[model samples]
Target: MSDTLTPPMQSADCWTRREIWQQPQTLNETQRLLRDNQGEIERFLRPLMEKTNLRIVLTGAGTSAFIGECLAPWLSRETGRRVEAVATTDIVSAPDLYCEGDTPTLLVSFGRSGNSPESIAAADIAAAKISDLHHLVITCNPDGALARDPGTHSHVVVLPKATHDHGFAMTSSFSAMMLAALSILSGVAALETRIDAICQAVSDILHNADTAMADLAQRNFSRVVYLGSGVFEGLARESALKLLELTDGGIVTAFDTPMGFRHGPKTFVTTETLVMVYVSNDPYTARYDRDLIAELRADNIAAGIVTLSAKAEADDTIAVRNLGGACDADLLFPYIVPAQLFALHASLARGMTPDTPNATGTVNRVVQGVHIHPLNP
Candidate 1:
């Protein structure tokens, strides 16, 4: 198949070559793979959650890090375990601060290559310092070092090879890992049913994503703010980064929890800005999400306001109303899909390469630079 015809998740088209026209099929493959693997994954993840005093740590770099952020809160609430999404960069640089405490840690690492220096370093640090550390490496690359390690209580769930995106930016790989992590932690016995629904929604969005984002890209917004609460907040951060990266800084993007935005970040929204919120499925969190949408609408602070949710409610007209309804954490998959589409379209609109959006050549599929210094303690 031609690069454009291949699913964005598995395509070899560098970011520079992809078009807004090709994301739906890519998304469909993502849903199919996850659904097919649901049973096997559930069998493995359920027992892990049952362990007493489990402390789950989700870590990754860049887009990979955002996956943990999107999953942390939902998993914490669902499993009632202590879960935090830590950036590998943060954990590696300050291992003493993050890994020093006494807790049996389930260290979940998300990486596309599974070979980033910090990802490898963070794994080493956890194994060395934490007494009861278990590892779940969710990555696309089977040959990467993170997937090959056998010394620790580690299980590597390599996503379907199709998920390994060839674009300089992460698209399918990001969603696949996020879905895998959610399945591992959701504790649902009938996970196949839920997976089916989620996958259907993803397919629907990808079918329409290119056209939708191409239109949105026409707006002259210069500042973008993404909002969500709980698990979605981390998704907001990832969405913001995708927009920034894909647009190559053509737009300045920011992210915050819906309530947290009012504290200080609201100042960034002006007539030229776009404010997007990922609404929560739970009542309390949704109320907060809705209230913020109302506040932003009342203020008219930005040129446009968009809301994304599984179910269509009052906020639908003001926002995009993307999916029907899934677990709150699963929304991360759909939420990030739009951002990825938006970024690709926006890059094309700006005459920039979607595959290698960073024209200065700083980032890559396997990020370069930074010597993985040998651990010294």
Candidate 2:
């Protein structure tokens, strides 16, 4: 290998591998984007929440879809209403199954470009079927068709331009949009109370990202398995996808619920694979996470292991401490950044562009080729 002590050349507008080293500024911008726009996002959702029989549907595709899945449990608890995260593809392919009966629905669409065909189609399907369907489009691109969709009786909330990641995988954009939805649908009095703590938490992770990524990159595993329970399960799914996407399928990846992994899926683990487990802060959930880690160690099937826990005191081989409050499901927000960074760096180590790794061009920042078929009469 040539002894060039620099990262690969990236586009002028894109962030470099070294830039990924500067997580402090990037994360600070992430917090400011959310903290500053809290009121605007909340105001946009106020009217939608006011409607009776309000059914909140969080819809998006892939990582965008996981944002809703991660927040669904906490949102339902906070709002004291039905909150469901449905994939836009699922809705577009089978709207009647997900749309439910003739109720007042708030279809909150999460997207980076807000122009995915399935996303826009899902919104249209909801409007055509549900008479009282309202929309809240959480997106990064203001010029995207979903933001400009005149047909939507919706309020489009565009995040800061910084939130629009140049990477093929969604990074800051995912967290920012998730935070926007949290502030609005969380039923919290004011977002300011949590801002300081969340910002601090993000800063701590950013400080640790370079070290974590350096270590993870050296492992050079054939496959990586991520495990989580509860809301973290969705986070694991997103983490796995980030790695797979950024690596251009160079590394086979998998994610499963802590409990679910034991049933046959554990066979996928080999001595050449790395496993990352997210231990829940809650006692019972933590037990499940611990048991899986124990089993993996006993089997000696993993090349290496990493565990993210609320407290520093984990009886595991590799542990990252994240001591924080147990305030609802909002905990997943800060906990997820490290995994995202890890995946990005792993991609870089393989000489892949985290910004646009899909060499074959099958996946994309915004998916395409779907023709929105009209719902038949």
Query: Cα deviation in Å at residue 180, candidate 2?
Result: 0.7
Model 2, range 85-202, lDDT digits (tens) per residue?
Answer: 8999999999889986578888889988887899888888888888888888888888887888826567777777766666677776777778778876764345546655555565
lDDT on C-alpha atoms for all candidate structures: 0.74, 0.74
Candidate 1: residue 211 lDDT (0-100): 65
- Give the Cα error of residue 282 in candidate 1, in Å: 2.0
Model 1 lDDT per residue over 99-160, tens place: 95578888999988888888998998888889888888888888888888724677777776
Clashes per candidate, residues 3 or more apart or on different chains:
8, 2
TM-score for all models, in order of appearance = 0.87, 0.88
Misplaced by over 4 Å in model 1 are: 1-48, 314-325, 373-376
